[model samples]
Target: MKAMRFTPPGYGGRRRDPDEVKRDGWRKQGLLAVSLDDQRLTWPERELVRQLGERLYGARLDKTEDKR
Candidate 1:
């Protein structure tokens, strides 16, 4: 039997390279943007999208429509 070790998000076993992180982040952002643009989600889905975008971008998602 082998023991497994756990690590945090940004620092884990077999650490990811800087370039890999940047590339993957960019890809995820692209997909998220496309999904938002499609405007096919219900309220909860939209909230999830916004939360994830805020997390990945380190800023709040625009709330222009929320004011309505």
Candidate 2:
């Protein structure tokens, strides 16, 4: 997957790649992860990250749902 590039607020005054951010975020939240730091993230930003993670990883489905 192509990594996303974004500059976190006051993040060493530099941009960070999505892979690094996602990895760190995942480590923080485990299998179900999102932003790098939840406390630092605004509600919309957190939601965006959550949606992104869902799109990338695919949200879990119930037994009645199709896997495909």
Q: Which candidate is the best by TM-score?
A: 2
lDDT of 1 by residue, 1-68 (tens): 87657655767568787657766877877532335444667878877887787787666436764532
lDDT string for model 2 (1-68, tens) is 97659856666676778777778777887754444367878988887886887788777577799877
What's the lDDT for all of these models? 0.64, 0.72
- Prediction 1 global C-alpha lDDT: 0.64
RMSD of 1: 12.3
RMSD of each: 12.3, 14.2
lDDT of 2: 0.72
Scored against the true structure, residue 46 in model 2 reaches a CA lDDT of 82
> Worst ten-residue run, lDDT, model 1?
30-39
Task: Kindly provide the TM-score of model 2 when superposed on the true structure, using C-alpha atoms.
Answer: 0.35
